[model samples]
Target: MTTTTRTIPAIADQIVLVTGGARGLGRAITEAFLREGARVVIDYVTSADAAAEIVAAHPGRAVAVRGDVRDRAQVEALFAAGREAFGAPVTTVVNNALADFSFNGDARAKADEIDFPAFAGQFASAVQGALHTVQAALPGFDEAGSGRVINVGTNLFQYPVVPYHDYTAAKAALLSLTRTFSADLGPRGVTVNMVSGGLLRTTDASAATPDAVFDAIAAGTPLLSVTTPAEFADAILFFASPWSRAITGQNLVVDGGLVKD
Candidate 1:
């Protein structure tokens, strides 16, 4: 066997802020950025203590700010705090903030439990959060002449096996926004993309999932295994790197071939 190493340039000097980086998938995304030598900032709503723990581990390499993505003022404050901590003009941002998605009681949700208002709440956090972050960072991106925004998405929109009407609808709108933003920002050297993956086990977001549900998904997928958060982070790093310089307005799925579309 031959030894091989990734050649991606060190982004140690670059600052990357991840929304909801206290634990689970968001934490993994944040760590991936740190591993790439990038100064990392994490934003969270209720995970401040957890965020503090991450900061303690990384020292100056990581900073965590408290804020709720659903609230515009909180979002603004979060970015402002991050700017003061890590300097102005953030270069890379990964919109991985999402409302808790652990299954409440069933593999599928009843329409009555989550209505239109609930759906709106989901969109407010996912799509609007991306919109707010992109808007807040665009001036910086324009001044710098280059930047990257990677939105975290789900694969539920492909087939809609379960009625995650709220979550799935919000993500679908997010997917549309990712593409539209890419077209609008492409001319400015700002790349926008979405990384959608299947139900990932070994994460808090999927913790409440039933065992039968896990087996169902694992057996249906071509890989016959659950996708790990760290593995999904690899795909995120790709879109954020120079290797994907020419790639944008695309949804890269890492769902183990569960759905071809």
Candidate 2:
């Protein structure tokens, strides 16, 4: 079978805000937007050096800002900083910031060991963070007459191969918010969607994952290879471009066919 890829036009005119964009998948997403000619604000809490490096590499195209997405006040400041730097309100927001946690499935807490606070923290970062960003960006969206929100998610919510209960649960809730937000913002010309990825081969969060796990996951996938941060980041651009104007309230899994859904 022959498959052709469609090129998405550069979103140079749009100012983008990416939470947790200093490192890991977030960094990749930030760079991807920059390469597409978009001005990007890299929001980070502790990865200041890494964020600075990204800004230095991209020069005028990217700026790094420190903010905690779980805090509404900080989220507002994040948007404000983006506008001040780029002289325009952020037209696109990617909720890619995750709660500080490693992806070592073997060390993860099982159902019995997990508690309410665990779930609460995850929800705070996954759901509340998105909420704060979307709320902060509403005015801008209203001004622009359109907006795009791409929520970063995971395939574990579907396959649960590692049973990362808290992480997966939080991501599932994020997916729910993505759809609900689409419904509420659709009439306003705003679109909300999710890009779910499986166990990425390597990232700060996934660095602790054993090599055996990666091999197993790759063997199960039809592509016989793990997905890269760059590949997953590319899928996120689709939702922010004109090509996806008609698409919303949907989840696109980019795990190299590890999970069919």
Candidate 3:
């Protein structure tokens, strides 16, 4: 059977929204979209200063709005702020907000030490946060007649080398949502997908990781270097670009060949 899809707007014409866009990988994703001439709406729970800096740097192209993605009302307000900024609703969304987490393995609770509450906390942000954003963006997506939803994920689900029990489990659930959402929304002119990255060389989240851990990950990768937030951001742009119009429900791993899928 053949499937039909709507024509996605060019990046220049798209108004983009990035959750947690003030720092780390989210910042890079926001910048990448802006560089492609897309008007960007940056969502931040904290990091107001960083968000302001980005807005100042980009001038008219970017605006930062504060919101907690886990709260459905806040998420809807976040989109409303975006609509007010650019005179149009967001046509593309990157669900990149993460609950507070640090990548230092030594500090992480061991699987046995971690509890259900830990898992629940992560799910509240990663899974539910994404759900809220998608639901909030639906009306906008319907208005535009085309949309792109790219959920940030992790390579750990495939390899589970470090087994960050709570964090990894939450991301695993997010990947499932990415596919299911794609199926339900594809015909309606929305494409949902995921971009999973390995241990990024450096980000506020990974700063706590020791240098040795970074070195080891680099050595293991075919590229002989750990991926950077900027590198991963490029792949995120692909899913939102015109090139990815017909592709959905798939996860593209962007970890420099660390995990083959």
Candidate 4:
């Protein structure tokens, strides 16, 4: 299968599903995909009003669906719902939704105090959701012979900062899943990859973090700056585009040099 140029022929018509796309970096990813000419499905566990507003802005270009990633049935149904609205065999998926992320704040407990339950909670969101999602989308990909999964992971697993063990573990697991899926799906032409980032300034997910903390992070990066959602989204788009057809089972870090590969 040959990939098209910067703008693929069917790419604009692609049905791109993004989990947790109602707000934050996910929202930016959704908007960017829509702007790039793909029909987008914005999946959210909550944030109904925010999702509605986003869909309203995009009209035919977007649709919002709600389902908990922790539940397998819900995850399957979420993909089904997306397919029912935009037709089956979605060309791409962006696994940007995460749980237990609201606690990455200065006021939150330190790494030593975090419990195992909290750690499990984080994986329940990504691992469970991603597994079901890939399962649900498998047949479609097999039929199409070409599909993409852009897993949104974090750089913390590579560069730990005081051990937010749970979040880091989930991301690390996600990276592993990416590699395995890439190999498993390669024969059928399905590409699986990850785009991870360091701490970001704004987003419902990052609201708990303090501004001063982010400033410190920005100072610590080799680039001496923070990466924006737009920059992160660009990396995601690269994986979806034909340019990255040869790349798979890889993690693209977009943290302004905070974590180098």
Best candidate (score: lDDT): 3
Q: What is the lDDT of residue 246 in candidate 2?
A: 81
Query: For each candidate, how many residue pairs have backbone atoms clashing (under 3 Å)?
Result: 1, 0, 0, 0
Local accuracy of candidate 2 as per-residue lDDT tens digits, 150-259? 99999998898988888889999999999999999987888899999998878999999999989999999999999999999999988899889889999999999999
State every prediction's TM-score relative to the real structure. Answer: 0.91, 0.95, 0.97, 0.91
lDDT of 3 by residue, 151-194 (tens): 99999999987879999999999999999999999888999999
- On the 0 to 100 scale, the lDDT of residue 219 in model 2 is 95
lDDT (0 to 1) per candidate? 0.82, 0.91, 0.93, 0.82
Off by over 4 Å in 3: 1-5
Writing each residue's lDDT as its tens digit, candidate 4 over 41-139 gives 888977788899989988877888897777778777777777788766677888888884674655555767878888788888878778878887777
On residues 181-217, what C-alpha lDDT tens digit does candidate 1 reach at each position?
Answer: 9999887788899999888877887888777877888
Q: If both were scored by TM-score, which would come out higher, candidate 2 or candidate 3? A: 3
**lDDT of model 3 at position 71:** 94
RMSD of each: 5.4, 4.9, 1.2, 2.8
Looking at candidate 3, what is the lDDT of residue 41? 92
Candidate number with greatest TM-score: 3
Better of 1 and 3 by lDDT: 3
Q: What is the TM-score ranking, best to worst?
A: 3, 2, 4, 1
TM-score of 4: 0.91
